[model samples]
Target chain A: MMVSLARKTLLHEWRRFLPAMLAVSFATLLQLLQAALVLGIFGGAAVYVSDSNADLWVGYPGTQSVDQGRPIDGDIASLLEMNPQIESVEPFYLLDGDWRGGHGTGGVSVFVSGVSTRPGAMMFARVLTPALRARLAYPESVIVDPADLNKLGVQVGDTASVNGHLVRVVGTARGLRALGGADIVTSLQTARMLDPAPSDSGGPTYLVARLRHPAAASSVVADINGHSGFGRYQAWTAPAFARLSVLFWLFNTGAGAGVLFLAVIVFVVGAIITSQALMAAVAASVNEYATLNALGVGKRSLRWVVLEQAFWVGACGVVLASVLAALLIWLAHSNNVPVAMQPSVAAACLGLVMALVAVSGLMAMRSMQRADPATLLR
Target chain B: MPYSNTVIDPNPMLVAENLTKSFTSGQLSTRVLDDLSVEIGAGALTLISGPSGCGKSTLLSILSGLQAPDHGRVLALSESLQAMDAKRVEAFRLHHTGFVFQGFNLFPALTAREQVQLPLQYMRLSAQEITRRADEALAEMGMAHRQHLRPAALSGGEKQRVAIARALAKAPALLFADEPTSALDAANGQIVIDLLHRIARNHGTTVLCVSHDPRLISHADRVLTMEDGRILDDSDRGAR
Candidate 1:
């Protein structure tokens, strides 16, 4: 009887609750996507940050992100190396190179990163795996994310030219997208051959110095400025560089504020739907609640029923949102969209939905409690 | 199909001492049940026959521990009704007291059998026990065939019988009916009154009925009339 009664109550409120639930679920899905993208950006940042091995990046102190392919020669690298606390300074062949391929498309913008032959075996330990290491080890090699495989139209054995310097597609690693474009990692030797600069000096455009402590990047940077002949490029920590990337993304694309504004819109739409459903349900069963109370079901029990109903609403909404969000993400991923999915971010999305559910519940709780048990007597 | 709950005192079937209630609508005040007292023997029907606005329902609720009297004490089966807390009172009502309301308070979603099992939730009984007791109660009320029907599907007489079956399913030591026949037709009302007398006589259960139906007075073992919540007329006293 109880189960059936509960089932009927569910049916009765389905009309109002279902729509609100879907709205909430869609909101949840959207929020999840936001979380996934944010986490991916953060995760990618962490991975790149940990790999840099430098205390500080010495840029021109101008833009937030994008090193601008600034070149620092061997003199500064040697000067940083002479520091007591400095371990070693290595320059990379970093440039904004364009790729020209395909049947119709003329060119594609890309960041050509020329890293050390064996940069930090400690940090790139995963990349050093026989399978992956073999790919990056080849002087004629290049790597891109799975998503880029379609755009670049290349496989493991395929070859492509980076700024007229042809390279083989050795392997594909997921992620490693920089500013929605692919990052092509190549050897310093290969970078020297390809870049319109000297390679024996160290970095073609960007110079990264590794320190014994790593934290002493500031002092090491100063020593490089004073002693090394080339001191135009500034040094920065990996995290600082990441913050620069975010700043660049925010200012350049308007993605952050746009997403946050969308979230606000979703929340309002969901709350309005949920409030209407709750109010209608309360009115429909006002007398029923009174009868239940008169039957000795206390206010506390009554409260549980309302809360349970809210939980039901939240659960339904979240599920619906997940479906919608997944569809949206898949659509983007299929259509070559930069939507990233992360587990921690999905959980955070659920948390946001629960918080919204709590707010909606708070709005309806008072009316549920004013059941007035004596109403049945009338 | 018999289920028993231990009555705290287990001596007196029902007892109420100095029960009082007051109703005040702004400045207008009416003192109802002013220190009224009553005691009825077990296994008998005590019909409280009173005019309208007599506070019969108020006194009944107070006695059932659903409502607390401003000045009174209720000792049911010798146990102090006023002593138990809200939860205990509800449990007491669940296992020991049967109630038949003026309107058949059937939960629209439930079948007739399920209506009989509502009180069993308080007992926390097994599903099988609840089912068996509900079936037996329905059978006793001649509602065995209608067990599958909901109130909306049943007639007035059938609904009343279902209500009685629900009350009887508890196997209460004390049965309370507040204007039970007011919603039924004359034919069905008489049938219900007769059923109440039969229950008290056959099961040795005390029945207290509060109603204005004079026809029901004849079926009661003892009848009392209340004016403004105070008992004024007693036919049993003349008989005794």
Candidate 2:
């Protein structure tokens, strides 16, 4: 019966509740899209780690993200190969490049990732097909993300100069977008040739190893880190390195702090608007409430009616927001905007929206105090 | 000759003694009910009739436990309403009293049947029993055919009838009506007064009504006329 009254009232007075529902919907949409954008942008910081099939990554000690890698000794590859659990070891080169397109576009900063052109190489195995990797075997051949072609002022089969070294765009791949600039993929020889100043004398920035027992990567990483002989570098499971990279960018940067502040603002503004609307709705029905008060209904029962109405409002808003967010995410993807929403992230945003509505309901309960049966006489 | 403030009845259901109530706005205080006393009987329609601001409504409010008098006390069904705490008084009202108002005060969002079922929901009755009692009350008020309509779709007379059904559904020992027919036409008003009279007689419910409508005098079992916060006449018209 309580549920019946709450539902019936909302259905009959939908116009009165539309503003509150819209407020909740707007809040949910903002929170969801903000989270997705944050993840999509920061997730790029660890694309190399996340997109690779490597079981473990060996890099310079204290490396926070893949892009911030400092060259470790090339000898680390042989040490990994010596482990019986390690099936293959490969050198991975990361370098900063300045690009000048053939059309004479201005120099653009780019991160050049050089990997083995082997057919079954672990590096970027998920992102780069075997055919695309084979193209990297040719000297001066490079692959870039299609989305960044306009920024680099180059297309496939066009020639470009990187740090005074001429290179050709052999192919274009998707999912190679970077946080601050475009990503340029090439062979190790090409990366070395493009280097104006060879940091660490042309050594690989990191060494990636494939394990025979992929599930044992954590134990292997622990054992390798415990060895005093391998002090020049650190060993991490691929997932851990990817997570570390994303977290470093998310918490250790100004951009991330700005996003966090914007999220807080959205929450505060949403709460205020929603609560005010709910309060108005309650005030509009005060006479009806007073009548109930005179009919011997308890104040506590009236309070439940308000809260139940809020719950329905929130539920309807969430459903509307979910549908709208899904469409917006699709539109963003079509436009090459970085936006990604995991199931867990979506769930958390929904939980926050409901909590906001609950608080609004509690604030709206104050209006019930005005339901004085004595006033009905006047 | 001036009449006594109290009435003699074999079955008095509500008794008030020297009730004094005042309203203060800023510095001026108007005494709405100054040292008034009355005893209303059960199983009959009792009307408190007076001009505007004559304290008839104030007297009814005190007797119904809707407001507390600044002085003296009210005893309803042998229980002192002034002595009970707020929660206990609410419980007492919930179990033994029902009310109808001039505005009809029905929730616009609910159907006639839903308005009637609302207070019954608070009583924590079973769903089947609630439906049965609500339908019965609506039928009693001749509103059963219109029970599914919302207030906006109903005529003023129909709306008032639904409000009466809402009160009757509780089947309380006491029923209070404050200008229940002011919003209706003369024909509807007569029909309403007749229903109240019949309810008092058939259900043995104490019907206490506060109204200024002189046309309703003949239908009431007793009439108390008031002016300037004092009763000028307490006339027993013998059951019709």
Candidate 3:
């Protein structure tokens, strides 16, 4: 009955609570979108490793993280393939190259990932259909995300100059989303054409190693690292490398801190708005609460009523936010904004909102405590 | 018949002993009740009358277990109200006490029936029984036709009647009214006073009323007049 009374009272005075509802909804929307965008950036940073078929990766020595390492000798691929636990080691090159837009405008950053022209030798081969995979055989031909066409001012058939070398766009990769700039996948020969002297000639950024025993890949990495003869090189299982990349982007750069700081400010503002609105509602109903106290309702029960009110308000806000977030995710996907709306992020945001409202409820309890039955006698 | 302060009343339903209550706002302090003692009998309408600021409401508040005295104790139906903890006192009030205020004090959002059902909801009664009893109380208050109306839709007298119905719905052993008719017209005040009298006489519920209206004292079975936080006269018209 106490809960029912609380619910009924809130519904009865919903007009008074509308401001609180809007505040909560706005907070939830901003938090969800910001967090989702950050997670999306992290996903984009680690996409090369996460979506790859290789179990182990090799990078230059003192490589603190992925996408930040120098090119290692391409011979490391043959040396890694000599291990009994290793299957095939493929040479891969990733570099940020300057590109001239189709309209001959200023230079724009383009990420060029170079792989073997042979089928099944590239990271994206697994995600591509056989028709698209077969097209990898054509030299100087590269794949780009369709969303990047407008960003690069180039279409599927347009020719663009990369590092002052011309390259042909053959096909589009559906899920090859990038954060800082457009991503292009090309054959090793074409990548060499674009940048003839990348570190040493014929050297690749990393050597991706497939494994005979996938689960034992980390142990193999440890064994390979123990060998001092492999100079200026570090070996890592793919997932560990992905984690390094995510951490590098999250804490090593200002992007993560900037997003997190904005989220915290939003959370605090949301909590204050909600708490003040609820306190106002409680103040308005002080006389009714005092009458309840005089009629023998416990102070504890009265607190529960206020807490329940906050809970319902939070719950309704979250529901509305979820719907709004779903629409935002759809629009982002259609427009290729690269936002990751992980279910775990949504759950965490829900917990945050509940905590915010619960604290507000506790703050509102102070008003209820002052509801003196003696006031009613006056 | 006039009763002396020294005389003990028999078969008392409530008793107050040397209750001293004082209010302080900064340096200014006022003693509302100074060593006051009183006994109220069951199944009667007892009216406490005084001019404004004579401590009538304070005494009512302390006696009804809504406020505590600076010193002294209250015993209602042989239970030590002052000795009990806050939770126990709340339970005691829930089971034994009902209150009506001069302002009606009804939840403006609730209909008359819901206001009457509020107390019964705390009693752990079944929904059917609570509804039945609340409807019965409303009917008895002559508000059967207006049970669906909120306080804003009701007149002052009608709002007071709903407040009375809410008090009566719980079937309390003691009913306390703090100027129940002070906000009404003469006709409505008389109607409320008559209804309170009927409730006390017919249901055997002890009704304690705090008022300054001389017109109301005539309807009381007993009248206690207070001055300077002390009872100056106690007249038992029922005994007469």
Which candidate has the top score in lDDT? 2
TM-score of each: 0.69, 0.93, 0.90
Report model 1's TM-score to 2 decimal places: 0.69
Best by TM-score: 2
Chain A, candidate 3, TM-score of 0.88
Docking class of 3: medium
In model 1, the Cα lDDT at residue A104 comes to 48
**Per-residue alpha-carbon lDDT of candidate 3 for residues A1-378, written as tens digits (9 for 90 to 100):** 322767777888898778778888888888888888787777788878876788998998767666786888776766787799998888888888887767756788888988766666647755566577567577778888887777777888778888888887888987777667878888777777777465654688889988988999879999899877655689999988987888788887788789778878877888888888888888888877887788888888888888988998888988898899889978987877778876888898878878888887888778887788888886
Give the candidates in order of DockQ, highest first. 2, 3, 1
Error in Å for residue A268 of model 1: 7.2
Candidate 1 structure quality by residue, lDDT tens digits, B1-240: 011221222355878899988989999989877889987766667899788888777887787777788887999777787888877776676567777777676666678887777656556778888888888989988999989887889999889898888778778888888788889899999889888877887788888898898878667767888888789987662134
Question: lDDT tens digits, residues A287-357, model 1?
Answer: 65554455555556666666667777898778877887888788876764556776766887788788777
RMSD of each: 7.5, 3.3, 3.6
Give stretches of model 1 more than 4 Å off.
A1-4, A11-13, A36-110, A115-177, A180-299, A354-373, B1-12, B237-240
Alpha-carbon error at A332 in model 1, in Å?
2.0
Indicate whether candidate 1 or candidate 3 has the larger lDDT.
3
- Total backbone clashes of candidate 2, pairs 3 or more residues apart or in separate chains: 0
